[model samples]
Target: MHKQFSDVDTVRAELLQNLVDDGETVTNLGSITRLEVVSRIEEVTKKIISSLSMEEAPVLTLKSRSRWSNVRFSKLVGLLLTMGGTVSTLRSDCPSTVMKFALILKALSAIYKLVQSDSYVTKRDIYYNDPQLFGSQKTLDTIVDDISCLLKVPRRSLHVCASTKGLISGDLCYLEEDGTRVDCTSTVVPVSSSVSGIINIVSSAKFVLVIEKDATFQRLVDDEFCINFYPCIIITGKGVPDVNSRLMVKKLWETLHIPVFALMDADPHGIEIMCIYKYGSISMAFEAPTLTVSSMLWLGLLPSDIESLGLPQDALIPLTVADERKLNNIKKRPYMSFHPAWEKEMELMLRWKQKAEIESLVSIAPHFLTRVYLHNKLSYGGWI
Candidate 1:
């Protein structure tokens, strides 16, 4: 894609001019080493020490990630905290922020030990280590993210990880940090405990399928969906996904350069889950660079397919008040404008006020998902 410039900075600057155009997925700067992680931590600590001695208040400044004022929607990056979003300073002297400041330091200290030893621990593990000081898991989680953003490094880079919540099965194989070779071909494995340490990834899969619910994921496995299909990988985070699962999906897409697809039931929540895999959520948007998969295509169980498939209307569930409200919110999302096909499916769901689970298709025939529905979709290019 480089036509003229051979210099790295010049090429990067030229490419960045349109980096966020349309539906391009954002990528992180790359992995940081143990020494670099330690160095950054020391540097931040030194800055705070410098601030403590000076007229400065030893405050930690970071973007207000939770507030809507900090979030903006872009077709290129989904809903993310803008570079110029509202900033809040955590002051060491303020009574309100003193505990918060202590928590940040505590997290940093814990990170220093982890990086120094090249050890990995989950956020839950860190919380349990000093629950009294952390107060709760949420408190620990927040500070970890704050430290991550402040250090301009991913949480995983700090050696803090999420507890595994997703399962994967497919033609993929890889070696984890401890040099454990995992072959998902024979059995479904939990997503890597340390995604950053994974290496030697190999896969012959033509595509990846992200499932909404674990029950649905298991159902496919029982049907040998992985064996019979177009040699694809399947993953599920149960319902709402954790960071590791998102990271795995991003990694697979980047490495394989294969089409990624999402299959959710025809409902507002299902659509939202699909969006989370395709476009990063506003809550964790700061990590969008490493989490989102913009190429993820909407696969089966679409609302528009409900009538045309000739499925029984009697079994279909009518949308509840909450579902209608959620659907409206989904339609209004700024990224929705870039996806009229998705929007049309959503509009149809709202109009009919009916929803169906991916399981609902099973009534047509046993193993219909692998045997018929998904097969047709993948074979004939039926995905959106």
Candidate 2:
């Protein structure tokens, strides 16, 4: 492995050199191009088709890794993992395994067809492709996920897409590969899974602010947060993030080389979501190099702020048994241990036995979040 650089400027410069261009078949994200991916799919599909035509035993091979076995924590990169093993179709000897193998092939064929047509389809689209065979959306989603893991590529690279569950507002414009011109500064738009495939970006934003909830995002947008103060981008995962939002945030931070801060409820769930954005999720740990935003800071509704800012007592909620369990679970994770500030915050929350939402800020003042909280945090550099 090569030496990893902690310098943000140097990393950004290296990533920028790999951005895609017209007819460019190379990238630092993955040297593999769309056309190259298509060819690979065709080659795999042709081999299977020929085997069946010759009355030979049809064999398939998938190289994948298990999260439980493969994932590990890294101080610099968060959860990281490597893929290994070539699983053969011969493993499908059992009645149950046979059905599972068939499902995998069906998904592979669907992906191959998608590449052949030079188009893309969401997981929902794939689910509906063979509703009877695929059954529920989860079933199809799992199969597609398995394929990505097996092929050692992102779902996007395979043309299997997901819906946009995040919203964005900022001083940014970009051209999509399909010729869709997106001017984020014009209006709030959902950050689609297709964001990674965008042709180019033109932005003058100084930084990006990622809010945990859509309501908070809307509040910031309503207040013209960017227009009033700094020319910056504001984004929301709407809850837990979908891939597009995460990818877009990662892309912006890498390309623009700007500060990225997260605002969330002062609770375990919110902290987990924030961690996912900064350090890639455990399930997709292998993709951390491209997906995670290591520089993102926690700009928040901190546990200390509940008292420091004198928020209404009524706004605080007692932690449920479930919430406590979640916090305990998070505390056990390796990454959490590495961040003493985060550990201190979790300790504060556990001591209080209560959690508060960002919306609770309104109890102190209707415009408090945008006016007082965020302004003070950004101005005073109050982030961890």
Candidate 3:
């Protein structure tokens, strides 16, 4: 638990205090339930309410780089990943700032209501709560994520719950905020806000396995992978992971002290998702210290394994134009050049111009993935 800010309560209270100190009334904030903004509200007052004086910029950092192969991996907890950044609203004339400045104040105001009511609102709720100002759900989401990064608090603590998008199962059980005891052993569990409150995780599992796709996750479940081979927890984000999924995995690793392995498609998007698990995403880089699982290793579906393992050639899909575009973007990323293994895989993919899905393992046999591929990969120590 690398908490950058004070506890959740303290942060929520401070947000409310800022609103009251700036003389913003409930009516001035507008209709939170109907997503309407009343006219004649002071935008200048909103900006003033949003900007806060800071003793220092955020003391968090991530694995970022400037040039090829120049990653600053040194764990400087108080330092930022990129060279320079805008922390406050005092400087910077970018047009983006004007909108973001207002959104931050709106978000803070929304959170204040949540704190006062002692309630939780989903991202969708907040989006619908103020569509006039938010414009789109994505805009609201980006602002909320930026707020979480800036405030140094988990989004859940800010009373924002992203629509849960991952599943979990295994020799594990936990309690939610409202005293709901969940037993994950016998069912596929949708991850709740396990990170926000007291999570009394009960598990005797050896390790946790995080799969990238829902199809592969279902395949493993159909094969009873966790029950037959090992006493372990299994999870999937279904695609690009959500915050709840990442947070659940981090909490499991920290609390259970078990090795966590990620299985993903042998493609740029897949690798990027896993990297977000191992290292925080560039957008949310500031929260890396609290969210990332640095020791999490890649399990399989590597590019070289496509040919080396002798899987059916028909199972491989040639890289599409869109896939190539994504690969090129990932290659240009500063952090990509630092890891030799990742760089090697990226090069191999570029050279071969092909990718494989975890489902490809099923070509060997229906249950080949869980029974053979993974078992052999683990037994032979074939993971990074």
Best-fitting candidate, measured by lDDT? 1
Q: For residues 220-337, could you state the per-residue lDDT of candidate 3 as single tens digits?
A: 7887888888788999988988888888887787678788889999998898888778766566654554566766778888888988888788998899888888888877765555
Question: Model 3 clash pairs?
Answer: none
Better of 1 and 3 by TM-score: 1
Task: Give the TM-score of each candidate.
Answer: 0.88, 0.85, 0.76
Candidate maximizing TM-score = 1
Backbone collision count in every prediction?
0, 0, 0
Worst 10 residues of 2 by lDDT: 19-28
What are the lDDT scores of the predictions, listed in order? 0.81, 0.77, 0.69
lDDT of 1 by residue, 1-384 (tens): 101111334423433543454232233347867787899899989999898788688878877777766667655445656666688888998999878888888889999999999788989999998788888898888898888877767778888888989999989999998899999996889998677778899998878889999999999888878886667799998999888899898878777767778989889899999888888777677666678776678887899789988889876999999999999988887788788998889889989989999988887887888888988888776677
Clash pairs, candidate 2, are none
Better of 1 and 2 by TM-score: 1
lDDT of 2 by residue, 276-327 (tens): 9988776676566567787778889889888898877899999989999999
Clash tally for model 1: 0
